[model samples]
Target: AQSVTQLDSHVSVSEGTPVLLRCNYSSSYSPSLFWYVQHPNKGLQLLLKYTSAATLVKGINGFEAEFKKSETSFHLTKPSAHMSDAAEYFCVVSLLTGTASKLTFGTGTRLQVTL
Candidate 1:
């Protein structure tokens, strides 16, 4: 089984400041990891993905995450925060089960950007 844990349920940051959202994962087999963002009533958007290609993956809007196999972590970071960045972020783990792919989602981290 695969699972993900988002360390923070809520993260607050001032506009133009740095942002960090921590995540840890576990899987018996090699896992495909992804970060997704949802703004207000909008649909989830893919931020980035790690599929054993690179340890460091960059995403949209200047966001990035590093896959650390040793620590079992894939934490998201951004040098600066924007008001548009305020939303719900999810840490996901994907696995191929039979002929289908199953995705496991974290509880999620709600990002709040302040002025």
Candidate 2:
């Protein structure tokens, strides 16, 4: 079984500031982790992903996450925050079950960006 936990329910930041969103996971086997962002009325966008490849993964809009197997964590970070970055972020953990993988989404963290 695999599960994800978003440590923060809400995060507020000013424009140009660094952003950090914490996440932790538990899995019985090697897992695939992902960070997704969703705007108020839009579809989910992949921020970054950690499969079996690199430990540090980078994605769109200068976002990145490091898969830490020792800590069971995959935390998301951005060098600078933009107003457009204000959205809900979800940390997801997925594992192979039979012939397919099943995803389990974490409780989302809502980011509030201010000018």
Candidate 3:
């Protein structure tokens, strides 16, 4: 068991619109938080990560996330949604439990972009 929850199973946004995806987490130790974007059959690309080095982390393609320890949340956002942005987004947490580093994933949030 690790910390991290994506509140929405799916979200829809029109092209050129803003996009928001929610995520919450719980961890016993400091965690390495990450938001990964997967495009159709492609491998996950790291959108951003928090490693206790920063509170607010910015990622590629106009995506960003803020780490709020008080709220136990790390939400991802984008200023505008592109037609190619339609894909599966995963909110994940990396933890070192025992001797291995593990990646725990939320159920996942699907982004539907429409023109």
Best by TM-score: 1
CA-lDDT, candidates in order? 0.97, 0.94, 0.91
| Model 3 vs. true fold: TM | 0.93
Candidates 2 and 3 compared: the better one by lDDT is 2
The sequence of per-residue lDDT tens digits that candidate 2 reaches over residues 1-115 is 7899999999999999999999999998888999999998899998888998999999999999999999999999999999999999999998787998787999999999999
Instruction: Give the TM-score (vs. native) of candidate 1.
Output: 0.98
* Comparing 1 and 2 on lDDT, the stronger one: 1
| Tens digit per residue, CA lDDT, model 3, 5-97 | 899999999999899999999888778899999998899999999999889899998999999989999999999999988999999999886
Q: Lowest-lDDT window of 10 residues in candidate 2?
A: 94-103
Tens digit of lDDT per residue, candidate 1, span 1-113? Answer: 79999999999999999999999999998789999998988999999999999899999999999999999999999999999999999999998989998889999999999
What lDDT, from 0 to 1, does candidate 1 have? 0.97
Q: Candidate 2: which stretches are off by over 4 Å?
A: none
TM-score of each model, paired residue for residue: 0.98, 0.96, 0.93
Clashing pairs in 3: none
Q: So what's the TM-score on candidate 2?
A: 0.96
Clash list (residue pairs), candidate 1:
none
Distance from true location, Cα of 100 in model 1, Å: 1.1
The residue ranges of model 3 lying beyond 4 angstroms of the native Cα positions read none
